[model samples]
Target chain A: MIRLERKFASLKENSKKALVAYLVAGDPDISTTLELMHQFVLSGVDIIELGVPFTDPIAEGPIIQAAHDRALQANTSLDMIFSLVEEFRSKDSETPVILMGYINTFLANSKALESIHERGTDAVLIVDVPGESSLEDIGIQNKNIASISLISPTTDNDRIQKICMSSSGFIYYVTLRGVTGASNLNEDEIQKNILNIRNSTNLPVLAGFGIKTASDARALSQISDGVVIGSVLVEMIQELSEKKDYKKIYNYLNEISAAINP
Target chain B: MDNLRDLPNSDGFFGNYGGKFVPETLMFALKELEDTYDQLKSDPDFLKQIDQDLCHFVGRPSPLYFADRLTKHYDGPNIWLKREDLNHTGAHKINNTVGQILLAKAMGKKRIIAETGAGQHGVATATVAARLGLECHIYMGAADVQRQSLNVYRIKLLGAEVHAVDSGTATLKDALNEAMRDWVTNIDDTYYIIGSVTGPHPYPMIVRDFNSIVGRELRDQSIEHFNAFPEAIIACVGGGSNAMGIFYPFVSDPEVQLIGVEAAGSGIETGKHAAPLNDGHPGILHGAKSYLMQDENGQVIDTHSVSAGLDYPGVGPEHSNLKDSGRAIYLAVNDKEALDAFHMVTRLEGIMPALETAHAFAALDHLSGKFNKKDNIVINVSGRGDKDINTVATMDGISLD
Candidate 1:
């Protein structure tokens, strides 16, 4: 089994939920981002999702969009992200690292993608490509790296089945009917949709999008196997980037992790 | 080439371009739109309503005026203008907006959203939304909001809210990004009325079909007025709606040549232009696969053009296929050349062409010797220059204020 499968299996064996933390690569700077990765792991993050910045992040809200802008301004590239993952692997190889980005950026760096498995990356979630389009459909074929798929509140039952069947790592259930950082969390709707997804596939379902607080993560984790936090942590990173305040971020991650685990 | 109009396939690929490269939240919406459009495209009541609006409301059948002075100045083909400048809202944008708003009404959407560059499309969409009594919102780049303030006021006067998008390059692409985000957020009752022949799947097809009225009218008008088909058809391509509007009907006509003019802001060599077909490679932007002005890192770079409408990093997917297949010839003209054409056409033809349309007129300077004196050369004057006076005056170092 791959790293993601093993990680999820271990979590299920322990009867615990997973906590995924997302940060943009090269945001602020490269060395700081690498340090943040180590810090995230130390803070009890089960999975690391590194955002590969693109010029137009249409799916993201203002906060994450600003993060992408800062990352691009720092000249982050696919090679640098891969190397970051490789360096992270040197210290801690247990946790799975997923690269989340737009389609064009991955398509532009197909060579780097072909070697991602060797470079310690586990999965990829391209926001624009969606479930109907496999990476292979767009002329990208890598059997090693798991292809993650998203199921939104707008996704119908038929598309949900299709998306779930093709997805590998885990089913990402968008908690609300909005972009990242949108605050409206209809927990009832999220629970219903996640249940609908679980009926179709046995893969672990993780709720993401609009998940901000530890309470939100804990509530979502009850209905699903895990929860992915993105925009809020990215916002905090930007706020504390100048001061290099990793301890505060680590504490916040620890609080969220403890909330989800119990 | 045989089934040129039957392109974009069931999967929305014009050969190798065009597809749904959007987030998962928008997929069902795109599919729903495609299904709805397929049902209503040939419905008699829908067709009748669209026809009634085109004839009565929009004042369709805009005259095909022969520009005698412009022809004489070029000393080549007889220059004829397909006067889309005379359409409702002062541009051809209403042709697509009217059809889309009707679709929105049929779909029971209570809100309408759109993105604009020069604000002509925003005004057109707002006009239809006001007519239909639907809530309307227009997203425009902050830079373009300042450059096209006249049309901005026109859109607001039509009772639509205008949102100045101050993100990215603060241009059309950024406006499109914000519009997509809004649509994803409010997918239940909101209908996004895409202005150009761009975006994912059904949008390019729907916009092309609605705007295809231009070519359908031109076909009969050319034979009626000239007694023969024009030797060439020329139009300016921003996201390529106007050019595609005229080129679709004549794609199978072996005798007639199709020409698309792209905006070269300074020069393509200067690396500050929007001539994607001329100087770009195949990539994806705003949900469609097309020729894009992007860096090696796959990041879309900023594009430049005096005409705000044409300052985009990518062209429509069909245009990319056309360029690859040699079905249409693409050319580019610089800002200085377009500015010169702006003055020349206003003086010689007594018609002030939009800065975007001036790019098409400038192509005559390059194709001057290609046609005989008797050959008819039809050009799509896509919009009027009333909105561009401020920019032109500022270029001459004079402030209208």
Candidate 2:
């Protein structure tokens, strides 16, 4: 089984929800990202979604966009991300790592994409290339790397199925109606959307976007198989990376993990 | 060869250049737009309404004047000006905005949002939105707001809210990003009126169709006046709306040459210009894959131009496709040449051109002696210089105060 499937299977068997942590690689610096990747898993992160910074990340809100800008300013490239993943893989081989970014960054750099599977990257979630588009559509042919698709609250029944038809790993259900880090999550709407998505695909649905606080994660985990924490954690990284306060970051993740699992 | 007008191939791919590369949240909205446009494109009533608006409201059939002195000064082909600057908003941008605002009303959208570079599009969008009694919002870069204060005040006077975007080089691209974010957040009642022949599928197609009135008028005027199609048609391309407008009708005609002038701020070699077709590679930005100026790391780089309108890092995707398929020729002109052309046109033709339009005028130097004296050449005078006079004065070390 792929690392994502195996990890989900293990989480299901243990009756625990998956906690996915996302961070922009090389935000403060490369070495810090490498250190945080390992720290994320230790704090009960089931999967790691490393942001390959692009010049334009339209899907992101200001918090994560700033993180991407900082990461790009630090000279982070796909090659650097691959090495970061490889370094993380050397210490921890069980956790799944997904590279999340825009289409141009992946398609324009074929050398980086062609070797992502070999470099321990398990999946790719391109924010822009969604709904009936696969990696193959863009001439990317690495079958080993699953292409994750996002389904938003605005997605209708027909599009949900179409998006799922081309998706793997899991379906990312954007809990809110806006970009990443946007606020105001109506649990009723999120639950209804996730249920509609579940009707279409057997693949695990991971709720993300606008999700903040342990209570939010725990509440969402009840409706979905897992939860992906992005902007809030990215905000924390931006605030604490310079101080090297890994424990504060790890503790925050641990609180969310414990909240969702318990 | 195979009908350039029939391009984008239903999926919005202008030969792998334009596509719906936006987030999944926007897919439904795009489909809704595409479906509505597909239904109304052939509707006679819709067509008639657009024509009436263009004729009465926008003051259409903007005169194609013979630039006698400019033609004599250049000592080349007979020069004609397709005067888009005479439109209601003082530029060709109003043509697309008028069409889009009608569509927004047709779709029952209550709020209209747009992004602007030089603030021309913002003012244009505001003008239409006010006429239609819709809530209007315009996102402009902080830098652009400072540079184009006249248009900024004009947009506000038209009762539109101006959101100054301060992120990502604080320019046009950043304004576009902020506008998209606003649209995403308010998707239900909001209709985003994209200002260029850029963005996802239907936008490029729709904007081109609306603005193609320029080319259609030129075709009729050419036969009535010059007795044949002009030897060459030239327009400045920023996001490529005005150029695409005038070039679309002539794209399939082999007799006419279509030339697009891009801004070469400092120069292409200095890695500061906005001429993506000349020095950049194919990449995706602002919801479409096109020729983009970016670093080797794939991060989009900042572009430079004295004209705020042409200082974007990416061109329209169709321009990229046209450049590749050899249907249209693209040339770059530096700031100095554009300034020279601006001054020359102001003095010789008694018509001051926008800095963006000046780039198209500057490109004429490259094509000098290429055509016979009797052969006609048309340049799209896309906008007036009223908004750019301050920039020109600043560059020349003059204070209006």
Scored by lDDT, the top model is 1
lDDT of 1 by residue, B1-401 (tens): 88767898998999999988999989988988999999999999999999999989999988899999998887888999999999988889999999999889888999999999999999999999999889999999999999999999998999999999999999999999999999999999999999999999999989999999999999999999989999999999999999998899888886889999999998999999999999998998899999999999899999999999998999999999988889899999999999999999999999999999999999999997799999999999999999999999998889777
> For candidate 1, lDDT tens digit of each residue in A99-203?
999989998998778888999999999999969667787777788988899999999999988887788989888888779999999999888989889889999
Clashing pairs for predicted structure model 1, backbone only:
none
* Model 2, C-alpha of B69: deviation from truth (Å): 0.4
Report lDDT (Cα) of residue B251, candidate 1: 88
Q: Give me the displacement of residue B89 in model 2, in angstroms.
A: 0.9
Backbone Cα, N, C clashes tallied per candidate: 0, 0
Model 2: CAPRI class? medium
User: What residue runs in model 2 are displaced by over 4 Å at the alpha carbon?
Assistant: none
Model 1 C-alpha RMSD to native: 0.8
lDDT of 2 at A190: 91
